[model samples]
Target chain A: MNILVCVKQVPDTNEIKIDPDTNTLIRDGVPSIVNPFDGYALEAAARIKDNAPDTKIVVLSMGPQQAETALCECLAIAADKAYLVTDRAFGGSDTLATSYILSKAIEKVEELENEKFDAVFCGKQAIDGDTAQVGPELAEHLGYPQVTCALEVKSEADGLHVYREAEDGKEVIGVKTPCLITFTKPSFDPRFPTIKRKIAARKAKIAQLTAAELTSIDPAHAGLKGSPTKVKRTYVPPRKEAGVVVKEETVEASAHKLFDLLSKAHVI
Target chain B: MPNYLKVTPEIIAELEKAAPGRVVTGADVNPDYSKDEMPIYGVRMPDVSIDAQSTEEVSAIMKICYEHDIPVTTRGAGTGLVGGCTPICGGVVICTMRMNRILSYDLENFAVTVQPGVLLQQLAEDALKHGCMYPPDPGEKMATLGGNVATNAGGMRAVKYGCTRDYVRAMTVVLPNGEITRFGGTVSKTSSGYSLVNLMIGSEGTLGIITELTLKLIPAPQATVSLMAPFEDLAACISVVPKFFMKHYQPQALEFFEKEILVSSEQYLGKQVFPRKIEGTDIGAYLLITFDGNSMEELDPIVESASEMLLEEGALDVLVADTPPKLKDIWAARSSFLEGIEEQTKLLDECDVVVPVNKIAPYVEFVDEAKKNYDFEVKYFGHAGDGNLHIYECSTDMDREEFKKQVREFLDSIYRKTMEFGGQISGEHGIGLGKVHYLEEAAGSVNMGLMLGIKKVFDPKLILNPGKVCMKL
Candidate 1:
């Protein structure tokens, strides 16, 4: 079985600084990291291959050249191959255009490998954009059934078994082969990359695809020109409420008080 | 023993008059003020706890205590492991934590002036904001700079950047006579007079109270990388540390510990980052090394060579943690080992002895062998690069008296062995009241007499932190 994991590089939120005058992120000295959820998505894919040695994993990302660092990390962690779909024409793409480009690149990747992927995995949401439309939209474009908030995935006889997070609790659902799965954060971090793998990853050449090479896409339906949505402006949201912490005699008392308060508001 | 004056209402009133609302007495005092982190030594509540806010306030408190013939123990955040801030004499414990303030920065001289009560974590963070780094990185980040200076505290980075004493450029100290005097200066070279600054650095609060400090800072390193190497046994693990220096890896920190201790930390933090086994073999010990340089490009070759060296020396495998989050997790686990042990053990005693780096493996092996005859469980870990070992004797099942007796014997043996190896009894933890006997044994009568002579010159009344360090109370 072969899998393709999608990853993205975003500014590390912990170290993020905002420009006081411009009200925009000060990215000058801020470090970039592989979106944490995407790392977990890759970890989910890696774990499946860990239990089943024959499973192959490939990782793809769409960004500028610096995004290759994220893909290299993906390879070091266990990706069998890496692809960077970067082109100047793909600039200013929104969720719809980004998903369209990714779906087209997924097809191109399939043709290059000459093998159909058994599953597609992605982070449920990129932390920077917080727009969760891409994964489900990619699945729509690929015409494959998809599951969101996949806590774990296991390979079965004819399909894949996925444990997805639900409102009440986890709900286990089985999906057939050639499906797509989006992942949230896992309990543990992704495994550490071995020395040999890290050294090899540092030197590995990533396959880059351009808009011109992906001939199936017409310029009319790609990049900024294709997207109809526009973000007029954005400003940091003002913090309106600070959380209230209850001081009680014991934890049980605190919990009871919290439950009573919540039930009074008909939330429980 | 010297007769110590008791705290009276009159004396407490005088202290309150000196420091205003910052003085607390009797039942009003918090229990934490009675002891330091290592409570096993002993605990005694001071009659009056004064939160001195400035050098003049400290001077006023000291003058009152001096006139009353009361012993005064200056305390910081009370994070000391050697009872250096315990206030065992029990007259007055002057806590300087509230005096914590960053005074100024001399950018030209690369020095920052701060109140003694300013914590290590605060100074380290504030310095980084100015694009400078304070080199002394002690494990207890919450410990105040005053306490660190008094103990001459050393930590993980001591192997590379040196210790607290190396960073202290000048200080304003209030002596027992209520005289505030300045020591050294913000000069790169000082040879004009007696080194009073160096003397007060590790005097353990016996001579004077550190009021303010001018600490030297260096440019911050651009990148840092940590690598962990697991070995089949500790001998193989520790023996490879000295080789890093010989091969010139210039590791910022080199620490080695057994798998069981890591398991304890894992339980405490509810986080698992280290492996218990590798390649189907149980990991006996791991050597954690950190490298910092101008950039990752500069550290890359150093990390590669160090990893290769460890693998050649019977390592299971070398793992790299160049990313910030991964490195932070590894160090968080390392820094919390003391808390982890404290939570699990009912009775605990620790000995921080620093020997020659080359003797670390043999010393570790000797401790392992010596534990067979003792009833308590022995857990040991230390800086492999600096040769300072924190070997703990712990027991949850033994009676308190029995544990105390056995631990005494155990400490006697360890301290004796430490001296035989030309090692110091207390590496970073000073000779507070708890370990004065061991310090006496290690320093010998003649050397101890010199220290006592020096102590008397500064504190003639012997009222400042009596019964600690070289002073015979």
Candidate 2:
């Protein structure tokens, strides 16, 4: 089986600082990491490879040259190959334009590797934009069945059974081959890379695909000029007030005080 | 033995006048104040306990206690493993927990003045905000800095940055006779007189009560990374430790542990970090190492060379954790070993012994062999780079007194062997009531006599923290 995972490199939000004056992110010294959801997507693909050694895992990303670091991280984990789809023409692309360009790059990558991926995996949403449109839009662009918010996946005789995290509870859904699955966080964290793999990954040759090489891509539907959505404003949300600790000499008294406070506030 | 006066109502009134509403007696006193983390040694409720908040209050209380000839015990967060803070004598217990405060930071001197009651974790985090670091990272983060100083705790990072004694440049102490004095200073070096600061450190509260401290700090490392190397067995894992130093690799922290301890830690944490098996071979032990530098560019080559060296030294594989989440996962398990062991065992006794780095493998092997003759289970781990092992003996089925008796015999053999290896009985944990005999046995009569003489000069009546360290009364 051949699986392709889509990843994005974003500044670590925990370390992200916001400029109080202009309300812009101070990304100068902030470290960049693989989007955590996308890491889960890559781990899902790696889990398949763990069960079936013959499975080939390929990781693809559409970002700047620095994004090769993220791709190499995926390679160190489990990916057999990595490709960065980067070009000046693909800069500042919105979710719609990104999915359109990724659709074309997938075809170019398939032709270059001479293997059609049986499954395509992606993070449910990149933490930076968080629009959550790329995965479903890419599925439509590729004309494949899609599953979102996947918590777990297992390969079966004819298809993959995905445990989807729904609003109510988990729902197990089976989709046939040649499907797309977008994973969210799971109960367990991804594994750390081995030193040997890290050394090899640092030297791995990451293939690149430019807009000129992706001839199938429509120049009209790529990059910032072709994006439909416009982000008018962005600002950090105001922090909520810290809650008051209700304590009394006894537990029952504390409970009573909490109840009275909640009742007065019309929350009970 | 000295006959100490009990805390009468008159004494309580004097203590109340010294510290005001902070004094408590009878059932009002918390039972935890009677013992430290190690209750196996013994516990005794003090007749009166005071939550002292300042050096003045401590001095006044000490003056009253001295006038009345009442034995006094000084305590901090009570996180001591050797019962260093336990109130063994029934007199007055002056706790410094409420004096918690970070007084100031001197950027010029690279020093921070803090109350002795401040916790290790508090100072560790606060220093990072100022782009500085308090490098003595003992395993117990919640322990009070005063307790750490009193015990002279040596932790994982001691291999690179030294221990609590190295960081304590100055301190304000209340003498046993109610006199207030300063020991050492913020100056980097001192050759003027006898180093009272060095003597007060590791005294286990036997000499005087620590009220304030000025600790040394260093610039925080810009980049840090940890490597986990799994080997076939513990001996094989530890044999490569000296080679690291010989090769001139100075890791900030170097630790080694057995697979069973790791398993219990992981189970306690409900997370699996290190792989149990790699390529059809079972991993018997792991060496968790950390390296830091000015930048990743400076550390990359070191990591690469160290990884290669580890594999060459028969490591099954080396795993790298450069990210925050990854490092937390690995270290959280390493730090939770004691909690994991305590959660499963009904009774426990431990010793932290330091030997020559080259003797770690043989010492551990000796312990493994010695434990077989005893009834309890022995679990061990250590700072492999510095040769300080935290060996725990635990059991769930033995009677309390029987367990104590057997562990006493067991530790005697171990400490005798440690002396034969020219090692100290306690590494970071001080010699409280639990290990005083072993300390006397390890440090011969001549050395013990000098320590006792020093104790007498600082505490003539032996009224402060009696039955600890070198003092028996």
Candidate 3:
């Protein structure tokens, strides 16, 4: 089985600092990390490759050249090949134009690798942009059955078995080959990159696709000029009011106070 | 043995007058003020608990305690594992936590002056903001710097950067007799006098109360990379530790943990950073190492050489965690080992013994052999770089006292082996109430007598943290 994973480099939100006066994110000191959901997507592909050693894992990303760091990390964590779709024309592309360009890049990658990917994996949403649209839109562009919020995936003889996270519980869904699946955070974290693989990845040349090389794509359908959606404004939400903090020095005392408050409120 | 005075209403009133609304009496005092982290040891609530807000308040409180001959136990965050902050003899518990303040920094002198109650974690974060690093990374981050100084707390970075004692530049201490005196200075070299500052450190608060301190700081390293080498068995994993020293590679921190503890930590943290199983074998032990240099370009070759050496020494594989999230994830698992053990175990007792680096494999094997005779489960891990092992004896089936009794016998044999390996009874954890007997047993009669003599010179009335370290009374 040949699997393709879509990965992205995102600023680690936990480390992101918010300016109190301006109410804007100070991304200066914030380090970039593999988008956690996308990491789960890659890990899901790696888990499949773990059981079936012959399953080739190819990871692709459409971002700036610095995003090669994320692609290199993907390469270190069991990916057989990594490709980055980088061009000035792809800048400021919304999820729609992004997905369209990704769909084109996926087809180009398939042709270049001489193999059609049996499955496509993506994070349900990028942490930086919680739109959660790219994977479904990409699947629409590719005309494949799609599954979202997948917690696990295993390849079967006839199709791919996916265990998806649901509101109440998990729902197992099966889809045929060449289907697109977006993953949520699973119980397991992505594996650490081995030193040997890290060194190997550092030296390996990453395949790059420029906007000009994508001859099948029209310039009219890329970048911010082609996107219809516009982000007007962004601001930090107002700080919530501080709630009552019961301090009794002991857990039991605190619990008793909380119980009393709950009884008074008739919340119990 | 000295007979000490107890806290009455008059004494409580006097303490309250010195610190104002900060003193609590009897059952009004929070129970946590009576003991440290290790509750299994002896516990005694102080008759009066006073939160001293300033050096003058501390001095005034000490004067009151001294005049009345009341036993005073100085406390920081009380995060100590050895009951160092426990008020074993009920009197006045002078909590310095209220005195917390980072006074100032002397960048030219490479020193930062802080109140004794400033927490280790607070100082670490603050120092980093100033482009400096406090290298003593103790497991208990919330522990007070005063408590750390009292215990001479050494930690993972001790192999490269020396312990808390090395960081001490100056301090204002209130002696047992209520004498407010300053010791040491912010100078790099101090050959001045009797080295009273060194004596106050590692005294476990038996001599005096630390109110303010000037600590030396080093410029922070620009880059750091952590690697884990998982081995099939512990012996193979631990034996490679000495190789780092022999090859002259200075790792910022080198830690070792058994697979079970790693699993527990992973479950506690809800994240698994280390591989439990590598290749076809279940990893028995892991060597968690870190390298810090001016830049990644400088550290790359060192990391490559170290990883190759680790693999050659029979590590199943070497995993790298360098990115911010990756580093945070790996360290969280490593740091939460104690919390994880406490969460799962019904009863727990630990020993922190530092042995010769080369003898770690043999000494740990001795601990393993000794575990067979006991009914309780034994868990061991350590800063392999320094040969300090944290061994825990835990049992859910045994009653607390029964476990204590068995642990007494268990520790007897282990202490003897530790001494045989030329090790100390306590490494980072001080000889608080829990390990007083072991320290006496290990130090022998002559050395013990000398320690008592030193304690007398500093605390003649036995009023400061009585029944700890060299103080039997």
Candidate 4:
């Protein structure tokens, strides 16, 4: 069975600094990184490949020219191949447009490979935006079975058994082949790429496909025009002002004052 | 020439449906998730990021990825000195920020259970509330518990309290197979088969993802005194460290700073640490010694004896201060040394090399002489009691690229010298991405083989933070 993994390149949010003047993100000098959650997806896929050596694992990413770095990382992790969907027309695409374009790109890839994807895996969400909508949207568009917030996965001769996170506990679900999955954090700790694989990934060339190259696509279904939501303003939240400090002469007095403050704040 | 991995619309749709509200895609990906504190390297951002609050959430995410075969990287506060936290591979980055809750604190057992994302400073403050202290202070106040465990970080207090590994009583780790297993426990000691807890301590997030940790705490020092002793010559200061140990002064902390480091530190703290400047006198080094005990009466004799010993051995005046604020000021200067060194250099790379206590003098002399041969200026300071020294090097007149090359050579030479004296390549900072190559040399062939074998046993898929610590898999 052929498996596909969707990965994306994002900015390392920990290193992000906001442009105070404009209240917007400062992209310059900020490093790009692979969405950390994708490692679990890759690890999961690699496990499946290990369990069945004949299985083929493919990685897909959508981003600018620099996005190939993410694919290279996947290759280092033993992904058999990688594909990049990059086009100026795809710029400023939102989750809706991204899912649409990626769906098309994956379709084109299937046709080119002359095979069908048995399953697709994705990290539950990206850290920067925190808006986890693409995976479900992609699953919806493809009309395939999907399991979200997955923590555990076991493959059987019939299909796959997955453990997903619920509100208070976990829910076990089984899906047949050709399903999609969105991983939850701490699912399985992602594996590190071996040295041999890293060397191969470093030299692996990523295939790039522009919007036009992704088959007959409508111009209206690309870029900003295809995006349904637009960000209007961004600003940093104000710093919390220090509260009044009540001083007391003795430890008992201080404790009473602390109790009073807690009472006033209704904390106890 | 393109090596392409396939993604399908069916998979994307399934992922979206599964995670109704958390997934991020396309231009929604922000830039801040890309890099770490390492100054030289540029950013490499993740395509998607996730904030997981529970083990189930993490496991669910892993199950999906396992089916499709995606790469993932884990991140904490991103205060890493090396590139270990950078998702050099752009996939999913699981941010532990939301998982920062202190789960439990048992004062009786002297143990605290905390989520991996909890900050060290927060833990220290919380521990202090109960008249206890978490002694593993790694300088960076914002570093997370998980990051500390990942790196097995040590700091000035390591001379007394030991590093993170010493205090880690238990851990909840997520394996590559998405299994959340508990290792070790609240029990003080264990003789388990593999000691997976110890193995994971300095694994650099390769073996497993640490979700929660139970750390041991100690009673706070009751009465503390700090002293600053100025030496007329560098040899005297270096020679006095081992003497303190031999005399059994039992100092909680013993640190040494050269003239350059002291002056820079003073400037950084914006306060005069030394009573008077000994200018043009070629004063080589200054030592800061601190003693802590249960009572002032108990500490007074020890402080007096240490002072008398220093005076007798070095013939230099030793100033002792017991006032809280005054002692705090002196410590502030010492802790601010890293920033001061950064302020004084155009570019700097630090070597956290540790040597045998007796070899401290020889190692310092060797590094001092080697400085003249190198293309950069070198400054030395650190926890002298533990023989762990931070030797920082920066460009003198060379360009950036040349300076980096020379810095590598200088560090290589120092590592060689350290090994000859039975020393470690890193005393506090674990073998993150920066020290991977050196770790191989330091661990030698036999140890490296064992480490690799263990890595395979714990992480068969090699999916945990790749390219860190033990070379890939």
Computed on alpha carbons, the lDDT of every model, listed in order, comes to: 0.88, 0.92, 0.91, 0.78
User: What is the TM-score ranking, best to worst?
Assistant: 1, 3, 2, 4
Tens digits of per-residue lDDT, candidate 3, A1-268, equal 9999999999998777888787778889688889999999999999998999999999999999999999998898889899999999999999999999999999999999999999899999999888999999999999999999999998888799999999999999999988999999998889999999999998989999998778888778889998888988778767588898886779999999999998998999
Pairs in clash, predicted candidate 2: none
Residue B428 of candidate 4: its Cα lDDT? 80
Candidate 1's residue-wise lDDT over A118-235, tens digit each? Answer: 8999999998888888999999999999999988998888688898889999898999978899999766778777777788888999999998779897777788888877988767
Identify the candidate with maximal lDDT. Answer: 2
* Off by more than 4 A, model 3: A20-22, A238-268
Each candidate's clash count: 1, 0, 0, 100
Candidate 4 structure quality by residue, lDDT tens digits, B114-209: 999999989998897788989898878788999999889987778877889999999998876677899988998777797889888888877877
Please identify model 2 stretches exceeding 4 Å from their true place. Answer: A22-24, A167-169, A232-268
Tens digits of lDDT, candidate 3, B1-473: 67887778888888878988888898999899989878888789999888888888888888888899898999999988888889988888988898889999998878999998899999999999898999999988988999999999998899899899999999999988888999999999978879999999999899899999999999999899999899999999999999998887899999998999988888877777777788878989999999998998899899999999999999999999988878888888999999889977988889999999999999989999999998899998999999999999888889888899999999999999999889988888989988988989899899999999999898888888889987775
Proportion of true inter-chain contacts also present in candidate 3: 0.81
Better of 2 and 4 by lDDT: 2
Task: Give the true-structure RMSD of model 4.
Answer: 31.9
lDDT of 4 at A172: 85
Q: DockQ winner between 2 and 4, please give it.
A: 2
- Give model 3's docking category: medium
lDDT of 2 by residue, B1-473 (tens): 78888889988998899989989999889898999878999999988899998999999999998888899999998988888778888899998999899999998899999999999999999999899999999999999999999999989899989999999999999999889999999999989899999999999999999999999999999999999999989989999999889988999999999999999988888888888888899999999999998998899899999999999999999999887767888899999999889888999999999999999999999999999988999999999989999999999999999999999999999998898998989989989989988988888799999999999999988899999988875
Span of 10 residues, lowest total lDDT, candidate 1 chain B:
B1-10
Error of 1 at B348 (Å): 1.5
Error of 1 at B417 (Å): 1.6
